[model samples]
Target: MPPKKLSISRIRAESRVRSDDPDLNRSSSSNRARKRYRSVAAGSSSSNASRYAKRKRPPQPKLSARVLSILEDDMRETQVQNRFAPDLRAERQNVSYRPLTLTQKARRDGADFQVPTLASMCCSIVANCFDSLLPSRDNFDAAAAAAGGRSASSSTAKKPIKNSHTLKKTTSTRKRSKTRAFGAAPDSDGDQQDYVPSEDDTPATKASSRSTRSRRGAPGTASSISSPNQLLAGWTTSELHYLTRKTSEQLRLLSLAASFLLYKTLVEQAPQYLTNTIISTYFLPPILSSSAASSTASTAAKTHVWLPASIPLLSHDNSAAAFLVGHLTSAITAAREYRFTLSRATEEDIPLTVLPSRLSLAQPVSFALRSLQLHGLTRLQDATLARLFEAAEPGPQQQSILRLDTISLRGCIAIADRTVTAICRSTGSTLRYLNLDHTDITANSVSTIMTSSPDLQTLKLGYNEHLSD
Candidate 1:
């Protein structure tokens, strides 16, 4: 088969027809321009046109003037109604439009549509139930009559006699009796019931009843009628006197019990009955007392008060317990008269020794050092003595050992010059007597004591191997 060949004249006519079409000419020119631009962009270094070419976006459809104006009005109204939004009209000439959030929309529309709270709903349900369960007035009156053996009609007379003058006199007398019953004197011990006025009562009768009610419940009467327990509920003189009679061990146990009870009852009951001051003043003296009882009945077994560390009041970070210990150490030195010592064998004339082991659990040894007026401390380490005196030193928050008359550091093998210096520095002005026998203190501590303590009249320095003449 032979293939048909197109003539040069036919090809020329087709090319002329294609070139004559306006759309084809325009598309060809656009394609040529795009290709030339890309080629030129690739040759440039500074120009990023080839890497990030600008995309030609389609033109957005224009909205009508009415639709645009309506959108603007809605945005303006939302901004104006938003309470949290600042007034941009005062800050700037042009205010930007922001879409209202769901919260804003709800707030704007919630004025007339309030959703009741859970509490209100529950209260309403309870009230409805209570009202339904309550007996009617007639039933309540019948029940009261059955319980008290007195009818309502007998208390509140309903019948009126025909004699007008006699009825008036009887009514006045009845009113006086009712007033005496309902509005008895505040000091009167008899029980009183509320008086409900009936429609038959006159305006004058109602006024008189109100006056009587007011007098019965006057403020002066409230104070006079208050329970005696209310006055003696807190730390009072009676508590102080009771505590003065108790032994040191008893005081410690009382404080522990009180602290525990206070912590337990604070959530459910009032804690005003037992406060920190009460515990410290009354219960703490026995624990803080350094002197043992001089009675013949006092034995060696009753010499020490053991404090357990396992108790939550002593172990935990309780503010009340901390306050009690801190106040004993800083504010109050000795709540009562007592002497301090470490020996338990001598009980009559010698000061009593409160076991340091017991004290370490409830409070620091510093509290004893601060509280002791006549100290006979012994067998204590040098570091322990130094730390105790250091804490007792005067500072911005607390005072040093006040009115310290005497101190004995006998048999303290570890007592050094530093501890003696600290002691003298803290209580030098009040220190009248000091004993440093059988200690490690040298002539240097003696010189320090002589210079620091001006009021010192008696000084004992014996068996000190370090002391040189």
Candidate 2:
């Protein structure tokens, strides 16, 4: 059915007619209002029904005492673990080890535009940091005008002054105050007043008393810098430091001389080690001074004036002989170069008896003295011997001690049989005096030497306990 369309003019004419007829018009309007109400109610009801239908849920398990009890038990277990065994728990969801805080910004005035901004705060922080590194202005403009604008900011910041000038003043004043507060003033009689020390004694008094006690050779203070090297006995740091700066040759000669003095001191100290007739006769000085002071004064002699710095006496490890050989070789070279013969060189110029290479004296090849002048340094192992004969090659002078016709290791120890055998093998015929007195050499060594050197004129094996009777 194609509905008929009413013309606007016809509708308007009908509306006018209706207005003229009041009762008909009222009835028609009432009908229209009722129809509108019905349509609105129907639409609203349909929409609400669809909404409720979407919201409705399936039946759920009601809240029960058992579920509540279980929840409470689980919570208690977690609480117990957190209290006692915290390590057992899992980490938080969004966990971090660092303590993070929210970014904060402050509003200054009623208008946020006039508020202190982040840029201003940052600038202030930067300025503060810059000011910390530099000296603060003493007479800062205190009357910084508080202008109506936010830019007018006058901050007065200070910390306990730690500048050099302030520190010096404070320290000086503190010391003066301490002295005045602690020390007793002189009485009217001009007699020194002794302030009896009590529990309330000040730090200044304690420090003064400690210094006095140190001067008096306090128990723990004395022997604080003693070295294990018995050679550096009574040596001061100032003297050692001074000597270390000298030329190598000077150092070698001076150190050797100093060692010789110290060695003599060690002997005179009445060493518990067994002494021999050879040592007593040749090595020890006629008037052996036992005191350490006498040894120190050995440098006071006019001859040692070349050594401007005080000599430091120090001994080293098992290779003390090896160390001595280096210095001795250099010392000999220096003495030969320089016209002056050191006391050490003079003392060492006895004969080609011991390792005469230890001395600056040039040993004549024609001589043969079997007696050895071992300086009781049993620590002289094969290496020490190697260092002694390092300069002298294996051609002809290799057999004889220090390229001399004689060899003596009297009162020496730790000389192995093989060491002696090697030496015997090297020497063809120039060998004459092979003195192995009171040495650590065995019978096998003596046999090897006899076999090796058939024409050995003198083989003084006296006091050699290693040989069979």
Candidate 3:
């Protein structure tokens, strides 16, 4: 029939076969190949990633029931033991605590073994006297009450109730009195002007008025009678008699302690007390005597009073040395007869120039030194030594009056021929002992010393490298 109506299925099957052929469907085949390649590449990448990835850790095994029960039992036993344990915090805290009975026993034992010295007894008596002399709380209260009562009575007596007319008259009279008191000139009308005080007038008038008010207000005030002497006025005559009855030695000790306390406590407040003749005569003697004693104990006792033992070795750099030298010079001047030894246990270098200058004394330092130990003056110079030797006031004969019985220059490395020569020339007549140890002095200086110092009993030239026979 009609050239053959092609069936739809037959047509579709032929088209599909054609499409499968590579020649007929080149673009589709290329796409299919690309997809296959991409799939392969993705698979390879996944495999590679899996191979290189970090491995997870294996799970830990669970505890067995028996082990768990054992741990629980152990924990329970620890908890029970902790609960039953004694609370020792308080007991431990009291480890160092001593009972009253034990403390008393220890104190009694110490007292029984301890033997008090005369010095200790004297000190205790003096301390007791000082304590007794001091104003007590009750005395202060009584003084305050007396002062208040006096002020109140004086105020009441001075200020009486007055009528308005009388008050006006009083005020006018007061203004006239103030004008007269301030030396203010009256006006041409003969009436005192308003009198406004200047700054200078105000201060003086205020001071005078305050003083007058104080005198009128409270004559028995503590401030009016609180001086040291006034404070001592309250002491019974028997106490004064007891003090006067003390032996001279006891008096001297008391004076020494009193002076020391005064100087130590009130040096800044009242330095004029240091210049008191009574203090100089009584207080300085003991100090000078104590300082003169060559014994170690005596030296140690007086060391802290003037020269503290804690002074640094480099004394030249320390202002404390200057302060000490100044005070020492004054002390020497105060007690001239007593021969003192100026010894530095630490072997510090003292500036010889400071001695002659007398920084603290109005006059030059004058003393006949028994011993002058300049043991560690490494930087001491010849000129300084000469100046020190010539420090004394010249006598009528124009000769040095300085008398040094002993001069120790040990470890003074700066000493040279000039220094030795100067020392021999200045102090040669009186110099009994001279130490030139560890110095730069030569044989020539030694010869000069021998020629000059005929009475030299001791000459120490050891460790002088420049010295030769």
TM-score, cand. 3: 0.29
The superposed Cα distance between candidate 1 and the true structure at residue 25, in angstroms, equals 62
lDDT of 1: 0.45
Off by over 4 Å in 1: 1-379, 396-401
Q: Can you write out model 3's per-residue Cα lDDT over 69-106, one digit (the tens) per residue?
A: 43357454233222322123334565876545546766
Q: Positional deviation of 222 in candidate 3, in angstroms? A: 35
Segments in model 3 whose C-alpha atoms lie over 4 Å from true places: 1-310, 313-366, 393-399
lDDT values, one for every candidate: 0.45, 0.40, 0.48
Cα TM-score per model: 0.25, 0.29, 0.29
Model 2 clashing residue pairs (backbone) = 370-433, 370-435, 371-408, 372-408, 372-409
Instruction: Report clash pairs, candidate 1.
Output: 248-286
Candidate RMSDs in Å, in order, are 36.6, 42.0, 34.0
Per-residue error for 271 in candidate 1, Å, reads 37
Q: Across residues 295-333, which tens digit of lDDT does each residue of candidate 1 receive?
A: 211211111111111222322322433354354443233
Q: Count of backbone clashes for each model?
A: 1, 5, 0
